[model samples]
Target: MSQGKLSPRQKMINLMYLIFIAMLALNMSKEVLSAFGLLEKKITNANVATSERNVAFMESLSTMALEQPEQYAAVKRKADQVSEISATLDAYLGDIKRQMMTTLKAEDFEDFEVQDQPDFLDQR
Candidate 1:
């Protein structure tokens, strides 16, 4: 009740306020992590679909080349070059992804967000 001193109730209220702030921080961290997980899963799915489409595109090119070598020979050569370059780039990206996983000490990014490893929120 005095200006210089906090009463017991005031002290308890302050402690509760701090605890509430901490809990809010923890909840916000979880929400951020869940958002990141959702984004990662979307990117992963897009990469997979793109890779599959690339393979199918090359396969179709090869078939066309075989069916009409005179008309599609150049297409086949370009397809081979594209495939080689894609493989090289994919390997490089895979290496980077591996390093990221190792840094996080995570075996795999789960499809769903996990509340664990809240420290990952600090990586930024």
Candidate 2:
């Protein structure tokens, strides 16, 4: 038979093959998209947490500066160091998210919560 000729059985089989291929394509695309979303979310959350920590530490340093001028320089230095470390950690998290597989979801990360350190007066 010519290439144009197809029996009913052959047509059915071809249709089934096409449907199967489409489903596989859809599933794989979904997985890839989800992976990208997961990575984006992780990077964003890490960035936000680091930013909050930096702000809180900076505020604490400023408080120390106001309360004890004699220790202002030391407090400022420590705050700077903390900021740098936090920035480095944020960058590393971004890199890890970029390299992680799709199977790693947002649930894998612990919730990012900042706890305020107790002031000396509060310890009494």
Candidate 3:
């Protein structure tokens, strides 16, 4: 429709339609951004909760090892390694989330409607 010159009224209608489409796109983008922000927040919260539970489990394992080395030393060592790896991974993921939020200048997921962390797809 925009390939060549056209009548003034047709051009006006095309411009108006383009503007309407742009408005719709803007609204959709905001909705999509809100959804992504909500998802990110949920994942982050889940990670924190899981990490906390893992830490507690590791502590209990350490206590068991202290109480009975013959049985739990190996188990505790394995648990320690698992905890280390999980902690490292959680830290890395948390850092990425923080960086994304910072880059987008978005508010914490505490408020979803205002979040702008919609650029999470960029691997950079």
Give lDDT tens digits, candidate 3, residues 4-91: 8798998899899999999987675566767876787798799789878877988888898999999999998888787788779978
Give a tens-digit lDDT track for model 2, residues 1-124: 5699899999999999999999987554444655765776898799789778868978878888888989697878777887798779968976754554223346533321211122322444
Residue 123 Cα positional deviation in candidate 1, in Å, after optimal superposition: 13
Q: Which candidate is the best by lDDT?
A: 1
Worst 10 residues of 2 by lDDT: 111-120
Clash totals, every prediction: 0, 0, 0
Residue ranges of candidate 2 with Cα displaced over 4 Å: 1-33, 81-124
Clashing pairs in 2: none
Candidate 1 stretches with Cα past 4 Å from truth are 1-33, 107-124
lDDT of each: 0.77, 0.66, 0.76
lDDT for model 3: 0.76
Score residue 87 of candidate 1 by CA lDDT: 94
Which wins on TM-score, candidate 2 or candidate 3? 3
RMSD of candidate 2 to the truth, in angstroms, is: 17.4
lDDT of 2: 0.66
Deviation in Å, model 3, residue 46 alpha carbon: 2.6
Candidate no. 2 TM-score: 0.35
